[model samples]
Target: MTDNFYMLTWNWLADSPLLAAATEVTTKSDGEEGTFVLAGVLLSLVIIYFASKLGGELCARINLPPVLGELVGGVLVGVSAFRLLVFPESGSLAEDSLIINLLQSTAGMPTEVASSVFASQSEVISLLSELGVIILLFEIGLESDLKELIRVGPIAAVVAVVGVVAPFVAGTLGLIYIFGTPVVPAIFAGAALTATSIGITAKVLAELGELGSEEGQIIIGAAVLDDILGIVVLAVVASLVKTGEIQISNIIYLVISAAVFLIGSILLGRLVSPLLVGLVNEMKTRGQVLLTGLVFAFVLSYIATAIHLEGILGAFAAGLILAETEKRKELEEQVVPLADFFVPIFFVCVGAQTDLSVLNPAVPSNREGLIIATFLIVVAILGKVITGFTVFGNPNLNKLAIGVGMIPRGEVGLVFAGVGSASGALSEATEAAIIVMVISTTFVAPPLLRLVFKETETATEAVDKVQE
Candidate 1:
């Protein structure tokens, strides 16, 4: 049956008129290329929007966070399930993508053109996804109280330190000792455990109307600090893996630059916000406030990326500074629609990149990784959870909520896995284990965060009523 099908497919392909013509046509006209690229992008966006909305709606109906639903929806339509939404980042070529295949079959887009279009379309969608998260962080920053965030800085610093250290040490040591894994691979896996996905947690907190709460502020602060520390750790680990020696100067440079980029941008943005206000007031144009806000955020985002730090941090700083202005209320209202459009793209893309088939123990090779993943998952959760308890002098704060908020590793963890795999620094089992850890935490943390926060809120309200 397989040989007969292959023979028939070859015969059909050999008889294609367009394929013969396209084979000789090495280049397409600029207009032709543009039209094809746009079509692919439009179709991909349709899939993204529909998947995100349907997933979000279903999740909302179940009283779960809508973001969780968007993620699951992406999984359903993405490589792991339907292959409807896929990306180049996961080692998938244009041929592996169903979207590209569909376009090629329907629109007569040739293989070479399809490949180019796929690359361009994926990069555009990825950029838009990046923009979505930056806007999300900016919105989160706007909602946050700078004064409160500053007040919790010392505690957050402590939490960040512990969060990074506990996971790195425990994961590395446990893997090496218990699993008999090699030193470098174990360290890389441990590095994967150290990421705290501020974007995911912040979005959840916003949805729950707890963005400005004490626990929320601590989680945000620690998470921001965690972001910086995680980058430095990743740099150190990647260097160590590549060169067999850590570069002290590079480590110091990353630390200094990240600190300077964040602190410097916030101070400068605050100083310039007055001018921003004046500029906005002078302009009598529609969308003046929105455009100005986005430009400022994008400029800072560009600066941060150029300086080797997270762009979202710059966007967040921009929001914090801009929130101090009298036009904050207006700006906040303006940014919401943009967030509504772009933010789900980031979440959905994250989900689409995730290949959940690795989790299936039905495959004999997966069982070992599954066993190792169980260990990493436990460590990843407990590692961050312990950080919340380390916060001193905040008795009324929901410590568990703060801990749970830090639980999701999300995309940051994925970076560690991707890097480890690319660098050949991790063994097959170790890579699978790290991926499983990330996938488990990324999906698990959302519901757990809501549960912890909800329980804390219920307890607080009950006590308030009793006191009243």
Candidate 2:
């Protein structure tokens, strides 16, 4: 029966013009490229969407930040283990084989059909991921209250400066002394450590119900400033790497540009917001004003990036400037859905890049790599922790908690690692070390915050009873 069917199939192929043309073309030509690319993108999206949702739920159940779940999901998808489950044939094509050569050659073809396939499918997923980050930053900005930051001005500034400087110095010194790595990579690694992940900190504060309190305000305010400073540092380091020369004039320009952008954005927002509100009120369509504000945020973010400043700074500044407007709540409500979808993509992508398979318990035997990693970790921790000592006034406030709150490295660290690796400033060992620092910072912040906040709550309850 199978032999007869094969004969019939051959007869049909011989008789049909389309089938014969397709067969002559092979998978390398126009025949199978669409199918493979479509499959790859669809598979990626399904995995990402489910992983994000599952991670969010798991994080909440474990009393940890939902970002943790997203990170874990990213890791699962990135690792060889998960890839095998999804794409069993990936990375396994034998050499000198017709199928493998066709797949490889066809992959590079600039055919209209292939481009259309990528644009229709893969491009959308990539765009959604990018949009997720933009909206996420906008929401972060919307949630930020500048008045609270102003109220804690001096303290926040001090904390931010100390926080940036300490880890930077310690990290650089550790690399130079312990690893004997080259100057550029060491500087890059140290710079990566200097960033503090305020998102994790903010989430913990909200969970602890301290987000509206004075101390909480101070920490959040400092973190905002810290982010600004961190970006400036990244810009400077990047400039140095590119030119092989760090100019004092360039550093001055960067600082001035950042300051001007921040002040100008707020000033412009203040001037425009009244008119914006009036327009929104007149329109009365659901989310019209909020959508307008979001567009404005994106515009400002684009302008900032054009001027060599971080686009997120502009997005954040726009949010802070508009925070006091009457339309703030409406804007927040309108933007929440967009934020919910895209933000997890940013976190998951970050996690996906982390390759933990290379991390070994026997790293110590690697001598230099192990020592450098350990030293960098210690420097990363202590430098940020000591920033708590810089907290002025309120001797009763837990500076340790504030310092610990600033520990996670987040996107900023990844930026540094990417720049360093791309520029050939970092070796594999150094890059791995930086990744370890990021992982350590992310893992440590939540539990430490939980314990500190718990103790603070107990103490507050005791004090309230005493006052009564």
Name the 10 consecutive residues with the lowest summed lDDT in model 2.
Answer: 84-93
Report how far residue 56 has shifted in candidate 2, in Å. Answer: 2.4
Writing each residue's lDDT as its tens digit, candidate 2 over 1-468 gives 999999999998889999877778775554465665655465566678788789878988988767678777877765423531121112222232222233346555344454344444435555566566666667666777778777788888888898899888878876787668778888888898888876656656766667666667777777778887887788778878889887778778878887788888888889988888888788857768767898789888888888787676777777877778998888888877777767766667656656564467566534455557788788888888888888766888888888888888866676677778788887778877787778778767877777777888899899999999
TM-score between candidate 1 and the true structure: 0.93
RMSD per prediction, one decimal? 8.2, 9.1
Task: Look at candidate 2 and give me any clashing residue pairs.
Answer: 132-342
Count of backbone clashes, every candidate in sequence: 0, 1
Candidates in order, TM-scores: namely: 0.93, 0.81
After superposition, the stretches of candidate 2 with alpha carbons farther than 4 Å from their true spots are 1-42, 84-127, 361-367, 466-468
Give lDDT tens digits, candidate 1, residues 209-287: 8888888899999999999999999999999998999999999999999988888887888789999999999998899
Task: Indicate which candidate wins on TM-score.
Answer: 1
Write down the lDDT of every candidate, Cα atoms only: 0.90, 0.72
What RMSD value applies to candidate 1?
8.2
